[model samples]
Target: MKKAFLASMLAAACVSATYAVAQTPVNTNNGAAAQGPQLSADEYTAYQAVITATDPAAKATAAEAFLTKFPQSSVKSTVLEQLVAGYAGSNNVPKTLESADKLLQVDPNNIRALALETSLLKAQGDSATDPAAKQSAYDKAADAASRGLKATKPAAVADADWAAIQKQVTPYFYSAIGIDALTKKDSAGAIAAYTSELKAVDVAATTQPGPVLQDTYFLGQAYYTSTPPDYLNCTYFATRTAIYAPEQFKSTFQPLATYCYKKFHGAEDGYDAVKAVAKDNLFPPADFATSVKPAPTPADQATTVFEADKKEDPTLTKTNIADREFVITNGTTEQAEAEFAPIKDKEVKLTGKVVSIADTTLTLAVSDDAKQANPLVADVSVTLTEAPKVAPVVGADVTVVGSMASYTQKPMMFTMTGGTIEGKAAAKAPAKAAPARRAPARKR
Candidate 1:
């Protein structure tokens, strides 16, 4: 199966990478072709000569010149691939990534282009400060890894080389799998898959890493992104109930964190390297030193007495903020406003089914329909008091109540109110007070 898979991929790779080059043969008839933009025999020969040029500088210059002269060359993919490699080798990462992306744009499934793009994106991601952008880079790497796995040609690849490619690409596949598993809140499964990928990288790194090592490093990063810090010290790193124990992950994860920190912040305080991001993981300080603040004593406190007639009005729980809405109480649309208004400052329980989950918010539908109404017609969406360990699946039963509430447009949203996942129950109606009164009437 592996062989067959690789073979199919290789065929795809050829179509994407080399076929165009094969088609654009040099016209041998001297001036047979018009000199609009097409390559003549001499020009094609010159191009190939530059591709094979021993001097890196000369090759780059020649390739650039060829591209400038024949911007629409039929062998564009080939030219782009060579440029990517040449520029990358010259430490021109930006240009290398640009060329790699261009190659992908032309033939997205090209194996070499996919491989190059993955490496370049990973590199870029490592340097990015924006978490969103960094995550995007990792996503692109995962995509390239998928393409590389599918672009292999088993028939042409030597057995050893094929195995190596598998070792290299499997982490990408597993990294993606881990991310998906996390999305579903399958912590054990995600940790297992990510650990397997990390192990694979370790195995591959024993030799010259090539790409597998790079993939391993990025897999660790993705793991960090998907994993919640609170869970990491607890369930994630606990026992080997899933994949490896926390101890095992220490070698890769700690180093990865340190590397990421160092790369992002030069010699700054490692613990406080990153600026305060609301969503960033807050690992315990290594030395366990807590900064203590002075407390105000009763005698030192400033106090004021209000008039006997003074009154305190209740605060509004749900209000509009910017654009997005928030709900403090988790309940059906019909009950949300009332439920939140009375106990805006107090804790409450709301029940609903999952509708959708975005980065920071979860949309839930209250199953209010008895027979004729929509199941989620009165569903209410709420932002959680704490971010969920895993994204809840659509249609899953859930209950959320929290303290903060903000109103929104459309289906009207309330903001964050403190809450918990009370168990889901059927939206069954109360058993009709069964004409039981008829028996009482008889007694009367």
Candidate 2:
């Protein structure tokens, strides 16, 4: 969850010639009229002294002094910009922010100022513990980023430098907006912002793995958490992230990618194909299409099991509980009769969890190979010889000895008669009710 940092870009750009103050040609007409702010001899001397300082600390000191003396100077913006650069170079975050704000007051569209402010605000928002404060900071950061995105290149900046600045700051701007949207639980908004960010940058060409990879992961998460989750896109982006993620992150993102792919495809059959596609592409192919197949029905699964088991033992169809249950519940009428024929009038010992009781009939979910079938599909209906002394509680384990009387297949039930609870425990006392407290007296 580490947020991207653009402080280095801000610091470098501000001090470099890209953001240097515009220098006007010196006029030798000292005794004549001046075109712009004609600085006095001392003021001009101080300006030169500030700009020519060797180190950032000395530059900051000189710039502050110049600004203190010439508060209304025409070059105030220039001095403040220098101070911003100086403070940033010194790693003085508070003063750097303060200087950037001062520069913004004079030149609101200043790219360096806007970039620094937006990045700092986002960093603060990321670390904030209070939800309201965090949202407010992120909201402000996103606003600044929006304005920065529209900012025109400065007159003094070269075309190449401006392009480089754009390439660096634009992604961070979009990321701020997307992260804020994610915090607000606006998954669609986050996806839109992140998509715009990826389109703005060549993520596959990025040499650094931090920002682009992380944003790609976030984009996948946004898709996953959408109203109706876009599992296909989620799988694509998540797999792409895994392709570029660090070794530690590979293990983390791989499972998410696999799960989404499996959920969308209904099986793992084509997962290797998806991963191969993701390794070379940032987005899904234009011709991409996939369909989710429904899981097999219980009856279909039972038939599959029966067929597989019959390969080993031909007599399994008549003796296996699963095979018999499948035939009785899901097979044709003739098949049900064939399976039920041999067991008629035979005494069987059944062990299962009690599902429900009505008068003398107990519905049970018969267990097979130690695993019980779902209680809702109760397969045993035992008719007791007589009403017992105590009624058995639902979900209690019990053994019944009864003769198989009959069965119905559509709503499958196996009727047994002459049944009795082989062993029953004494019923425990009901839990005592907690004492209620008196209401507190109303204040006078």
Candidate 3:
């Protein structure tokens, strides 16, 4: 989460040219040029020492000395700003942070200083070991980022320059704010902050691996974990991240995309199309909700499957045992009677796993609904003509031949009598031998 610090860029840029008092006044304070404020010979000499320094370390030292020599100088804020840039460019962490604090004391809303503060504090929070220390750093980061959001264009920076500066720094501020909120478990606040960040940054940035891309994924998580969860929005944003995530990280985001899609739409049938659309757009399209088809409810599925089954086998002729079980169990009393009447007392062949067994009675789970139970339950009750020589164990796959007798609709069990096991029964596991008893120990 380290930021591309603006101060580092400013460092070399600051020392590249001599300060022209005409075009950009060196003695400006709070964005207002002083009325011909003249520097003393000594002050001018010190100012030249700072502005003419060829390197960040030298410039920082010269600027610090100049500020110490002329504490009440008209260009104090300017010197502090450059000093921050110089320390930042030289990667002097403590001095960079110190100079930024100094700059903020003179101009509380200095955009560059606030940005550096947020970035440095956020980095500190990320690496801190103690809970209190991390909390303190994140709190400070959020505060600085909040101020950066409200920072106005300095009067000295032209309109065009201000516009470019905003483009550069605004997303960084919002991202910091969002991260702090996310860490605090404030989902709504995180969502708002990250949304604002996406709005502020170049759309293309969201597709790259960095603050914007990471925040884009975080936005999805915030939406998903928010109260009463916004699944569709989560799907859209997460799908986008999965699509653009770097190869090593691609798998990280796809599962959330699929899971949230299924949760919202009731199935993952059309998620790829959504992903296809998300790849090119920053936000979901207008028809997003209407586009995905929600899967049928359980009752709806039963009704549809039953009706199709009835049409396919009007007289129950050639209807498979699984289909017969479905219509009889789930269909209305009248529909159940219509299907069951045709096959009454007729022998049928069924394939399923054994549910339970006694000497001459076998219970079998013969339908999808029956087999899906936590502990498999029987859909068919069979009274065998005689018990098999080798006992059929529970959960052993077998084929049963029996005459259909009667059935109950609720909790759906069909009674069948004069049954026989017709195929190879699943092999039983070999019995384990008892372990040898330990020898009695001599009295201690």
The most accurate candidate by lDDT is: 3
Task: List residue ranges in candidate 2 displaced over 4 A.
Answer: 2-36, 129-133, 153-161, 203-207, 290-444
- lDDT, residue 362, model 3: 91
lDDT of 3 by residue, 77-192 (tens): 77887788778768776787888899899999888788777777776776677878877887888899899889998776789977876676677678778877888889999999
lDDT of 1 at 316: 32
Rank all candidate structures by their lDDT, best first, as comma-separated numbers: 3, 2, 1
Q: Write down the RMSD of all candidates, one decimal each.
A: 21.8, 12.0, 12.6
The candidate that achieves the highest TM-score relative to the unseen native structure: 2
Give candidate 1 misplaced runs (Cα > 4 Å).
Answer: 1-39, 152-166, 169-444
* lDDT of the structure predicted as candidate 3: 0.74
TM-score comparison, 1 vs 3, better candidate = 3
Ranking by TM-score: 2, 3, 1
> Would you list the clashing residue pairs of candidate 3?
none
TM-score of every prediction relative to native:
0.39, 0.64, 0.63
Model 2 lDDT, residue 432, Cα: 27
Q: Each candidate's lDDT (Cα)?
A: 0.46, 0.72, 0.74
